[model samples]
Every structure is written in structure tokens, then in C-alpha cells.
Target: MRAFLLLLFVFLTLGAAPARAQQPTPTRVIEALYDQLSAYQLRRYQPDSGYQLLTLPSTFSGPELAALRLRERQLVRVDLVYSAYRFDPKFSQRQLNIDRLRNLDERLPGLLMDPSITWNLIEQTGCTTPDECQQYFHGFVLYIEKRYTKADTKAEIGRLTARLNATEKKIERIRAVRKSPGKPLACGYPHVEDKLRKLTKRIKKAYDCTQKDRRPRTVTFQAEVSRQGKVLNVRLPAVDSAGAAAPPCPEELTGAIAEGLAFTDGFLLGKQRLPFTVTGRLSLPLRPQQGFKVTGYYLADSLMRKYRVKLLRDGCQARQLRPGDATEEDPIPNPDPNVVTRVLERHPDWQKQTVVADVTGSMYPYTADLLIWLQLAAAGPEKTFVFFNDGDDLPDKQKRLGQTGGLYDARTNDYGRIRQRVIEAMGAGGGGDAPENDCEALLRAHQLAPEAQDIILVADNHTFPRDTKLLEGTRLPVKIILCGVTDHINPKYLALARRYGYSLHTLDTDLTNLSELPDNQITIIEGVRYQTTPGGFRRVSGRAE
Candidate 1:
């Protein structure tokens, strides 16, 4: 009887061993855990940000783990174990609740040391289906080293303060120029046709493009005018190789013309005689159109509609002129220039830039300016352009901070291809919200142009960037050319510049640094008062002290 009982016990124990063998081994379960964690990391990781991943062995001491956690930025960790739970109709939350509690522990079990060990107790699932479904527990240990440390951000703050001091000095120089008086010149005031004729004769010798193409074409030129009515600088559009194929006019001509040109009065915006840029044209084959026609090139058409502009007197009059004498182009017609134009005009030294623009509908005005600037500037392979819509028609809920993407970049200086990329990004998505994925676009721009000298971010003033957290991962010097700023600047941008050492630029003001100011110190910029605080900064209320 004893021999028969022993045989039955052995047979029953063998049957249970086969059932346990069907479950996944600890190694397979840990592998599955890493797969899930990797998906989460993929969403936020920036290229070249320097992150380390580690899968600690189960035998790792608790003290060692604590030391690692102290030295590195503990991005995230997952602690779980893999085991099958019995199918249950009523207790579906049972297995999930237990697994979560286990993950919350400071130290996870060393599953690698005992691959064959089991919890022994089976938990019930919350499954409600008529058919049976299998359920299992998951376990893993994932550590992601963070990129930015507290010390890194602190050092950037110091740099920002230094930059701000330098900017203040630059403002002083600008103010001195603005205070000067408009000089008297031989040119008559507002005699548009007569003055144009005289001016054209002065520049006829320097208008070299006409020598190459006898075709009647209007080449437009833009000049900056100080509030004191002094002509500060001049720029002519790059030769249209696709069209007239003329070479750029001589630099000597631009310098000579700038030296001679002066307005009777500085351009006025409201009560202030602010600096402005004016556009005029040098038409080839010096002859007036047979019918009445506009004198200035169509370059400033958008600028005219957006700002108050006066034509030097519309409608061209017929006049015969000699080859050595071109018609005097109408005197400068001031247009309130946008940010893109201002940055390109003021910073001629900013070359080989990777220009990243937000291409939502709100940015159309600046987008037009960007296209215009690109058309006028000399083309080079080093200049890269990137345009982004918030997401490629992505639904709002699915948009994650650093991952939301509707970004396209063109490395070549080909205007046609650049324009196509702009169209492609815009077509993919209409910027969904007022807050944009600006930092995300910037990060992608850096990835595309890793060796670029600097990043020129053309941004909107009203909206704040959505992924500012990722700014810490950026490597290049960011020059933010902000648009739509009128009465007040956005404080979020101020904080960004302060924390990351980015320079903030508008039409007239450049905030290179926002650190070292005493708390509650008020600084006026471009007529707007801003108060600095430990938290960041804000547009001051009421009048300045």
C-alpha cells in the first residue's frame, strides 16, 4: 500500500512541474520590461544630449544604487517582476495593484540571482470577457542619466548677466545716434520726380547691372534711415539668376549712394521719429514708362499694407534720359520693417545661419519677410532653413512636448527648394494652439545643422514656447528674432533668455542677458517698462519711476 501511494505522489508532482515550465523565464520577462521602457525614453530623448542607460544586476547592493542615484539625474526607473496571474472575472485589479506596490520599493528584487524563484501566490485579473485571457506581471530596472545638472543652469545665468551689460552699452550708442539732427542736403524736399532724376544721374555710373542686361528691369534697393534723417546703410537685392542673371551692383555704389541720401525729416511713427527702412528702385534703360506707373519696386508691397507708408507721390511721368544718366528713383519711402528684415539688416555678420521659423498662419507676415530676405541675400550652401508647424495635422491630445513634429529643413540655398519645404510644413499642419513647439523645432534644427555657427530662431512674441524644458539640451548660440512685439514683451521669452543665455531680439531691442539685475529693478526697453524679479521678469504695470 505504501509503494502504491509513493508512485501516485510522484506522478502528481511531475504534472505541476510542466505547468510552471510553460511560464516565461525571468530573462525573457526582464527583456519585455526594457522594451516598454525604451518606448517611453524614445519620446523625450534629444540627440547628443548624453544620457546613459543601465540594467543593474539583482545582486547590486542597495548602498551602491543609492550612490548612483545621488550622482546622476534620476530620469526614471521601472521595477517589476514577471509571473502569470490566474484568470478572474471579479478581481481584475488584483494583479495590477500588487505589481504597482512592488515597483514603489526603494530597491527591486534581484531576479537575476534566482531565475527559478516564484512568488507562489497567483493573483486574479479584472478581465470581463466571456473567453479566457492570459495575464502576467512585468519587471525591469531602467536608469536614464539626465543631461542638464543644476550647475550647468547656474553657469548659464552668469553668462546671461554679462550679455545684458554689453547690450546696455550698445543701447547708449544707438541713443546718441538717434539724438542727432537731420543734416541739410542739396536735394529738394518732396519734388519726387525732379529729385529722382538727379539721384539717378548720381548713381548711373555705379549701376553696373544695366551694362550686362539692356532689358528694361527694375532692381530695387533698400536703405536704413536713422531717426535723425541720416541714411545709415543700403542693400540691393541679390541678382536674380533665374531671371535677368545680372551680377550684384558694386559695393562702392551702395556706399556712395548711402553717403549722399538724406531725408528732409526722419520718418515718423506716431510722435516718435523712429528708425526705418525705405525701398526705391533703379530701373534699367533709363526711360519712364509710356503710361503712369508706380516708381518703387514691389518689394515693400506687404510692408506698405501692414504699416503706414507714404509714396513719394505715385504715378511715374515720362522723361527721356541719356545712357550715362538713369532716372532718379523716387526718394526713400519708409516702411515699418518686420523682425526678419531688421535682423538681417542689422546683423550682416550673422552668416551661415540655420534659420528656424515657426510657419503657422499667425506667422505669415514674418514668413513673407523671411522669404523676402532670403531672396535679397547672397546664396550659400552653408545657410540652412527650417520651418515648422506645431504638428503634421496631429490631433491636440496626441501632441507630446518634445515629440510633436511637423518640421522640415532645406540645407541648400536654392530658393525654390526652400520655398517648397515651407509649403510642405505649412500644409501638414496649421499651428494648432497659441503655444507652439518652438524648442522642439530648435532642437531638430540643431540636429540638422550640427556644425552651424549659430541658430537664428524667428519666433512670435505673443505665444510662449511649449517645450522649453528641452532648451537645456540645445548646444548652439540661439539668436531669437521675435515678431509681433508691440507694447509688451512676453515674459516667458525673458525667462528663456535668462536661464539658457539665449539672446532675445526684436525690431529695435536686443535683450542678450537678463541676469544680475536687482530684484524689482525696472528697466525700460523700446519704451516698454519691464521689472526684473528672482522668478524671471514681467512687463511693469502703470508708469515707470
Candidate 2:
């Protein structure tokens, strides 16, 4: 069946589909490959020949005899390339492998040598298994090393020196410019309310009052702000330390002060996210002789937010922080639901169940509970999880807009990891109309994992799936566990259950031990579908299971 779909995809992509002149999308083309291939094979794609052909303009011919023949040949050449990629899947895979190495080399020039954590494998490899990706990455590293010699390193160093010289010259020129009584104002300082509060809080916890103070009691610094409010320089007053060891002020605390200042509106030249180095003074009131200049970099606002008090404290005794006070920014603002409690209300047999869930912020509470339950339940090792963002879909008169979320395999046996990595990333933020991409996600999940018999979907009950075609097809009986919503159940979900012989289950996380709750708006009795309009549940057209 998948083979057939791949062939049809090839035909359509080659501009060979009858009556459908429009070209196939990259997503659909990939989906076709997914339909026929194993997960390992998913990484492979035609780098040189296949992708080029797929991107070529469709064939066109006119009345001129010579020109018409030429056009036909051009079309055939391109179609043949497309055919090779589609028909012989191995060719495409080879292309993808070649492309991957080249891409890695181009993007991260010194990837193997540079042990920086900047290389994000998941984003780079597009969600491949960790082992497969690492294997490929290491191979590419070796390939790069074989050619990168001492001469190459020397040449790179020379280039860096030249760039540095040029930068220094530019800085001199900028500094040479005559200034007014005050530095040029970039603009009104942008509000740094959050950053300012955080900096103050960090400064207050310089020492653990409960424990004997080991380090500096006070640190003071002066900052030079750029036109755009970035911290260009930080300097401490020359301390009157009589040639002795300075008070040890933590670098982390001063660094936050610099960044918090940078985030504020300075001169406001042109807005930019940039780095600046600053030096500040350290002081200890108890030991006046211990004081010195400290130097550090001002971090980008976003990067600064991630600096944790716990980690920064390092070996220092932790100052007792206020219980309610937050040391870290709240995870994408939304109501926090205890997913574990909700999942416990009706403990699930996790074995043999493929979990499909909506992770949108609105659904986070319910989704969180589901994940907590998954963590607690000693489920089968076989279960696969799939997550998707609800994106735009079309219907008759009404249009669902702003829906653009991609599907990612967010499944893991380690439920602990899910809570930390996946759940923490979920925010009440997304695009697309009020409705989500549940239909598309389910369809994709179904295609990805055909073996899992029982499909359990954690869905938002507020909106229905616009793509009804997914329901029209042959499918497993789904258990649509409606979460975060109850009064309303999108009729389409019911339609899905009705069409595919699945059952509907709604959980009011607030209520205990509830099961299989019905929608308040629409009621189904026997085999009839009825919607509440001005009147109530008058039998609608479709059959209700």
C-alpha cells in the first residue's frame, strides 16, 4: 500500500497527475517516502539529482516545431531524474547522506575540533535517533579531519588575526569621533522590568546570612552603555587595597548586573543583540584591604534569563530564598495542571497503547497530567508517542487561520525526561485558528506506527479537526481522551469515533474518578447525531454510534 502511495507521489510530483496541475509540496513528497520506508531510511534523500528535478518548472510547449521538441526533451530529462529518486529509493538515500555531510561541514566549519554545545543535533538532523545521528556526525568529523592539516589551521588563525585587526581599527575610528556633552542617545531605554528585578534579587543574595560569610560583602561597578543600551564597558573604582588579596566577589553575580543593565534602553542606537565586556570593582566591608577590579561579559537578555541561582551558587552556601519568590522566569505563562493527579483518577494500562497528544498551552494541564500518568504507569516498552502543533486547515465557509505547528516524535520510555524536557517546553503559545492539527497529527502517527492497535489521543475538546477526510478512511477504534475542555466537544471527533468504531472519553481533571463523560452541547442517542441549536439535539444527518 505504501509502495503504491510512493508511486502516486512520484507521478504527481513529476507533474504527471491527471487534472491536478498544481505541484506537490515538499511535505507531501516526504510523507510519501515515510509511507513506504523504515525510520532509518527516512534520513536519505536525493541531494544532487532528485531534489533538483523536483524543484524544476513543469514542462511547457508551444506551436513552434523546433522549440516544442526541445521543450519535450527538457521535460523528459527532469522527469527521469525525479523517477530515479522515486523509483530507486536507494539513490535518494545516498543523496541525503551526501547532503547531510556537506551541510554539517558548511554550517559548523570546525565541528569536530570545536567542542561547543552550540551544535543542536535534533534541529540539524531533524529528529533522527540519537545513535544514528551520532554515528553519522562522527564519520563526518573524521572526514573533515583527514583534510584539515596544520597549514589549514595556520591559515585560519591568520584570517582570524586579520579580522581582529580590522575590528580594532573600526573601534578606534568610532572612538575618535567627537561626542556632544553626553553620549549619543540611542533611544528611550526599553523597559527591563523583569531583568532589573532579577538583578536586584541576585545582588541581595551575595552571601548566606545564616552561614558565616566566606567571600566579599559588597561589589560595586560602573557601566558604559552603548547607544543601544548594551553594556560596552564595566569598571570598578581603583580600590584602596594595600597590596593584599582582594575580596572574592562571585563572577556570576557581577555578570548578571552587567547584563541587566544592557537589557535597559541605553543610547538606543540601532537595536541589536550583542556581547560586551565590562570590568567592575569588588569590595568587602569587614576586610577593607580586600578589593580589586573584576572583568566579565554582558550577556544577551534571552541568554541571561537562563542563568540559574542554584547552579551559580556552586559551592557557596545557599542563601535562604523566599519560598514564593521566583529565581527563574516562569515557563511560558499558563495555568499549571497536575497531570499526575488527573491521570491517577482513571489509571490507564499503558501497555500496547500509542499515545497521541496535543501539547498546546491550552491543553497543557491535561497533557501534563497524561505525561505524569505515563511516568507512573509501568506501560509496555512498545508504545510510541507522537505530538503535533495544530496548524491551519480549510473548510467550506469559515476559515481557520494562524495554525502552523510541526509534528515531532516527543516519545520516550523515560517519563521523567518527558516532564523535564518536553513538558517544560510546552507553552500556551501557538498559531492557527482556535482548532489544532489533531487530525493531521493522528494521520501522521497512524502512518508512522501501524502496529499499535489502540490509539489514545489526548485532545482539546474546544475545536474539531477541519480535515474530515482523515475520518473517512479505514482506521483503528480511537479513544479520544478529551482534556482541559468538557462543555464542548467538536462534533468531528465524535464523527471520527462514530466512523471508525472508537469510543469517546472525557475527563474533568477537577473531578475525581470520572469516565466517559459526554459533551454538553451535542448529545448522541442510539445511532443518531443531533446538535443543540436554538432547540436541542434534533437528529442531524450523520449516524452516531
Q: Write the per-residue lDDT of candidate 2 for residues 330-426, one digit (tens) a residue.
A: 3111122343344434544533457777765445446545653454345446456766544312221232322344455545666545544343233
TM-scores, all candidates, are: 0.40, 0.30
lDDT of 1 at 65: 64
In angstroms, how far off is 54's CA in candidate 2?
Answer: 48
Give each model's whole-structure lDDT.
0.54, 0.40
C-alpha lDDT of candidate 1 relative to the true structure? 0.54
- Clash count in backbone of candidate 1: 8
Question: What RMSD does model 1 have?
Answer: 24.0
Model 1 residue runs over 4 Å out of place are 1-336, 473-475, 516-518, 542-545
Residue 150 local lDDT, model 1 = 32
lDDT of 1 by residue, 123-208 (tens): 22333333432232233344342332235333433443344345445544544643332322121122222355555555564455
Q: Estimate the TM-score for candidate 2.
A: 0.30
Report backbone clashes per prediction. Answer: 8, 23
- In candidate 2 the C-alpha lDDT for residue 75 amounts to 20
Give the lowest summed-lDDT range of ten residues in model 1.
36-45
